[model samples]
Target chain A: MTKTSVNLENPQGYPEVPPKTDSVSPIVSRVREVLRRHKFAYLSVGTYIASMVVFGLIVFAKGSNPFSVFAVVVQSTMFNGGSIEQIVLRTVPISLAALAVAVPARAGLVNVGGEGQLIMGAIGAAGVGLAVGASVPGPLTWVLMALAGGIAGAVWAGIPVLMRTATGASEAVTTLLMNFVANDIMLYLIYQPWRDRFSSGQPQSQPLSQSAQLPSLFGSQLNLGVVVALALVIATWYLLKRSHWGFALKVVGGNQEAARRAGLPISRLLISSMLVGGALAGLGGMLNFAGLEIQLVPGITATFGYIAFLASWLGRHDPYKVLIAASLFSAIALSSNGIQLNFGLNGSIVDILLALIVIAPLFLSKNRKALTK
Target chain B: MNGIEQTLIGGIAGGTAIVIPALGELTSELSGIVNLGTEGCMLAGALGAYAVTVATGSAEIGIAGGAVAGAIFGLLHAYLTVYRKADQLTSGLVIWFLALGVTGVLGTGYVNDAITPLPIVSVPGLSQVPWLGPILFRQDLLVYVGYFLVALIIFVLHRSRIGLLLRATGERPEVVSVAGIHPNVIQVVAVTVGALLAGIGGAQLSVGYVGTWFDDMTSGYGFVAVAVVLFASWRPLRVMVGAYVFGVALSAESVLQTNGIAINQYLLDALPYLVTLIALVVVSRRGGRKAPEALSRALTDVT
Candidate 1:
């Protein structure tokens, strides 16, 4: 493909030159073309920088030196040992959540139900653990919990997929509303039948047995969830970029009519993609539950699903890129504690930064397009 | 006087909280732009209104401030979604995040303070009636404002030339452009106006209802408002009914609690959202024939 394309003149209306006195080398011209194609990337980076300056001004308005806040943020999030581990732990759920969105996004479907799916997954895993933690072997119990979590997530996501396919309802709104429902269901369970009997006061589920908990990594605060998340990321990257099913799903996403014409099972592909995305999110929930919480409680996901949605968009729905974006966002989120402690600022200040990061590119790219025109 | 009567009155008041935003969303949807950021706008409006009302000791000024704050965010939304051609849902979500953060930061001071709430106006003659009087005649000023706004919206939507243009733009922008009106301008105006109303709704929630400031206080009213528009099938009068129904569902928790019913508070809290999801499915299954053509295309057509 490259060899065939290399000999073809740039179709963007660049002037043809005589071969005799060509001033630009072919390699340089190719490099320039690549750069031009990625102009939006450059603009997005510029916007990120501009947003940071605006955030600094906001800090100033709060009566603190922006530099000091930044120093504290960076020192705590990046330079510290415990904070780095915290970011890694946080990244596990966030990256998986991003993948949950990214996988379905490749098929031109927006699966915003990651939050619901994650919660359901956690509930599913917890249910399994509670039912057989004492009777089943440790490794078998863990395996069953993971499978239940994945299946639960898939089924949770499957509801919206079916709604979209059968009735043409907007999955975006339905998935979002389902998040609240999932939260309520989780709350009901913890507050009632699943409530830890021995523990008084706060409403929480009984703790998972030792067999149900995930093993930590290298004696660090980080758990094996990171390994699971990274493995899923690599597998997703392969499936999206190389697999035949991935190609078919992309075709379906690109044009349903064309895919139908090509004899692809459109509904099957759509449902499968959504299910895979949901399962990934569910697994993230299971990982979070098994690795960190060890008990079902409210706020277990901590809005990781929403943050992951932002990360997916920032990464342009690429699995590898989403991994990087999710890590960056998780770091910033982990550092918000320091910002709150040092500057007396609300921890939600990180949300403002995240919002700006998402929006700046839109405005900048628009300006660039107008300028180019 | 009784549980049923009290619940009915509370329902009307709670329903009004959603009505303003739902109305705003209807207008926005009619113009082919869906601003999910209505939630964010409402949050900002609530904080802005509460802060100003606390400062000046005037609820009216606070309401106006809320509208202004909402309009500002609406302008940002319009600029991004309209001019920049960003994804409407994503842009709306980002706007919401921004509002949540900004309000959370600025509203900390006002959390402990309270402002004088808008007084309920009772018509001397009409309010004397037993069953309907307290529920309808005796209410806050915003309820009356909502009534007038609904009537105005219905008339304008059905009878006016601008309304024709708005509907046409949502159905087919190319045709509207061919007819010499810029669709983008109409969209911007529609979204901003919608946000302004949503802000007012937020103001109503804080000043007229809660009479205090809080961070992220709009909850999911903005999203529920969006659902209400869909449930109403984008009609003005139906939006009123939908809002009232949701209000009844929302107020049920307190009413039941007051009556000593043994129900989980969290389940009650989840009722409105559950209803919304069910309503969406039911409505869609019945065929969403009333949805704008262009808006549907905007949601489904990727590329």
Candidate 2:
């Protein structure tokens, strides 16, 4: 279809010539737009910086020298072995979930059910691990468990897509509702069938065999999952930039009507996006389970999946950008632990501090001024 | 059966969580802006009020604090959804993540007490009457207000001029624009008002019902509110009915567990959602009646 026309010439009931204004050079104008958008991104970065400054002030208020606290936060998160391990462990899930969400986002579908999908995948993989942890060899058990996790996560996500395609229901509501459903399923598995026979009444599963565990790649709480996450990031970047399927997904994501008119199968594309996204999220869950926790319990996801959603947005849906954003958030998350230990800070303050990072960008965009009445 | 009475009581008590948010969501949906951030808004309000009440020892102030927090969330949402022309769904999801993360961090400083919620105010003569009296009149003040809000919303939506205009904005915003009313202003008002009510609903949970706020106290109440809105077909009064149904199911599961019944608590907890899913299927089969035509369109378009 042609672009809709506007009656731009009509002014005060008379045709008028367009008024000329001071114009920037084309290169300069393009540079300004780039700078303006980057300004928004930096606005977000500033909040991250501001939060650290605020944390320092809070430490000063509590009678500690601000410099010492800053040094402690920096040194612990950046140089301390244990803190670095925490950052590495945290990065795997955040990066994987961000990619999980970004892929579907690139395809124009929203998967708020990432938390649920991750939980379901964990449950799926945990069930597989527990059932076969005793008999299967190490490598095959890990692969099969990861596959089970991916399949379970995909199926959990598929429910919403199916409902959307079949009944024209909004996926936002359905996928969100499905989070509770997946959580309940996880609860049931842990509390009932999967409850470790030797455990006292806590809602947890039996420990997997040593063979079911992922091998540590760095021997510093960093596991082979980090390798897998980095590899996936590179693979995802290539697939989106070079693959035909990725191109189709992006087309359908950006505009379904346009994609449909161009002979793309919208339904198939939507479903495939959900599957891939769900699989990535599930893989994140599998990594969390095998690489870090090694057990399924209530609050198993620890809301990390949701944090990853923010990281994905911060990255603007670019896998490479996602890596940087994830690492930044990982640092911020590490600082929370340091702040708690050194300054007796409350843990939840991390969220309040992070809010600044999430919110400042909206105000910083040049378009923001133009959009508001 | 006596079993049904217990379920109804539990449902009404439990369903209060859904009523306010769903009603507020209906307003937003009516104005053609889907506030997917409702859950986050509610959670923030709940946590904010809970912490404030415990710290200050005043429920009213706590409730107001929740409202303020919720309004701030609404303002952010308006800025992104209306001003920036970002995808409403994405912006909402972002707000939710930010809220969840921030609440988790800030809540560490808060040491909350077990809430002694507002007592149920039984209307004297009405509460003295038989079953209906005890069931309806002998309820918490918020429950009564919830019903009243439903009636008020129904009247506002169908009869009032502002309501008509709001409906028009949702259904055919272009028509409203042709009449010289800015659709964005209408949407902002709708979302703000809706968020305010949702905030109250969450506050009611902290200071009026459950009497305590834990991390993530909302437990997907906002998500259920969406389902309630759809189940009610976006009507104010019907949403109350839907909320009551869901409330009853949720309450019944807990009661069953308390009574040591052999029924699976897991299955029971899943019941309300399963029913909601089924209701969604049925609603879709019938086709949504007179919904906002431009509900899912980009906010820049008046229609």
Candidate 3:
């Protein structure tokens, strides 16, 4: 008879006994195995904790009670229903803007011009709304503003896209450069041509007519933007992960030479990806403009493009994950207002927290494996 | 004398800030690291220098403070990208955001502070020489140092063993390792030193140029420096030329404003970025600079 060896995790007729797993309990070992498999979840939690601790130190250094600061942050953002509404409202634009980054990323492009594209979208929407919003029916006004916004965003993204494909200029740099140009253009408009003469204080455009505002959800504080955002999230998930075009984009992004050899329209696919991203960002602008701030103003984005860019990275470019990340970031951002009110801390402290959260993941995991691959 | 001579003088002085940072970025890129945080490093330097100057009443010491601040940032970048193997661009952007926030938080007390600007000096003989004299000779102390640095960097990069190793590391780290040198160590040194220079540049901007502290006072000069490095083809002398071109543009803004010209200040603010975008496209199309092989890998799109 052959010699038989006994297994440690389980043994014949000994299923009830704990394995020789370092003399640990069977349930404990099983839980350890699950934790090992889901290291990313732990990594994110660890990073979040580390960031909050660092932020607490900052608050403490400023002579505020760190615990109270944290409590205020949590209470102001999480406990109240009104804050949740603001977070969800903020998520609408952020999620759409994140999709802007996510889509182009699929085609092997970094669309750092989200800020510019979003601003252009807002400008387009404002132009259309101010021009024809009152003359047209409300529904038609919405349609026209959205189209203008989307087309403008596409045009903005198209500039760097054209430069990249035609001249090999790095889109990362070019797109970033465009943000300054877009900002200046907006400033020029508001400071002069588009200035609302009837208003005082900070310069802003004329407010959209009441009819042009986003319709409320059954007389609730919520508007149609969140619903639209959700629909787009699902739609983008389908198109990017399920369709042949999406498959082509993957091939192009993964290996350009392979895409070329496979007869994929590499340039078209790349361009289309970026254009759709720009359009989505523009649509985000329209939603925000109609849904909340009814007028074009400086600081309109509140760095939405940048925060959304970070959110895209946090989500690893998955549209569904991006939405969640967007919501989370929105909560973090809106907390700044409360923090400032409560502690008199500078508003930019939120940037430090966001930076810390984004940076922690950079080094915590297996080096290259943790990149946005 | 008209504003033309004054503009030329201002151009050389203002250009010094940009040329210094561009040289720093060139050094970093030659080591296979594209630090997008050069912007943040400059901000760190600007605030550090300004704060130090306010405390000690010494612009010279403040510039040193700036260099130290920049080095700290550089060290963080080196650790993240070189040691931890984090994506270079991501590490860079995060550092920049951190710098932006930190400076904003710390720079509050110095917003209204003032200092004695770097004194303008002239070489007596050079000052006597026609059109070039007043234009070139009459510049702040940092401008002269900037000239020396440009010449020194050109010699070091093209002719020195260290630069050869740096270029080798950027092109092929495997080869660098085979040659019995630690490539990452060299890269760390190069990046840190590069960042130190950028800090000095920021110090020049605040203590040497404007003599006052303000939020984002460096504006986007650091970014322009990065662009300048690219169009300069990583050449030190061309970096000066590129920087001076921007300096002229910036000084032109001031000159036009002082003359009561009607161009919108906001539109004028956009000029540098627009020009950078246009120049980048033009230079890239012409193949004016060859990017390091490693840099191309660093910038590869990730999803």
Go through the candidates in order and give the C-alpha RMSD of each one to the true structure.
Answer: 6.6, 7.4, 4.6
DockQ of 3: 0.64
Stretches of candidate 2 exceeding 4 Å from the true structure:
A1-73, A197-202, A365-373, B48-65, B101-115, B171-181, B298-303
> Which residue ranges in model 3 land beyond 4 Å of their true spot?
A1-44, A365-373
TM-score of the A chain in candidate 1: the value is 0.87
Cα lDDT of model 1 by residue, B1-303, tens digit: 888888778788878889998999999999998888999999988988898899899998999999989988998999998889777777888889899889988888899997899889997999989789888989888888888889989988899988898899889887788768899989999999999999999999999977878777887889889888986788899899989888888888799987889998778888988888788788888986668997886676532
DockQ of 2: 0.38
Expressed as tens digits, the lDDT of each residue in B176-286 for candidate 2 is: 887678888888889888887788788877777677767788887887887778757787877888888888888788778877898767767778887787788777767
Candidate 1 stretches with Cα past 4 Å from truth are A1-42, A197-202, A365-373, B178-180
State interface RMSD in Å for all models: 1.6, 4.3, 1.5
What's the lDDT of the predicted structure labeled candidate 2? 0.77
Best by lDDT: 1
**Candidate 3: residue pairs that collide:** none
- lDDT tens per residue, model 3, A1-373: 9978877656665658554457888899899999887877887788778877887898788889999977887899999778988999999889988999899899889887788888888888888888885777898898888899899889889888888888888888888788888888888888888889999899998899888888989887779877988998999999899999998999999999999999998888988999999999988988888888888898799878888888998898999899998998899899998888988877777778888888787766453375336
Q: DockQ: which is higher, 1 or 2?
A: 1
What TM-score do all the candidates reach, one by one?
0.92, 0.86, 0.92
Model 1 quality (TM-score) = 0.92
- The 10 consecutive residues of candidate 3 chain A with the worst lDDT sum are A364-373
- Residue A125, model 2: lDDT of 83
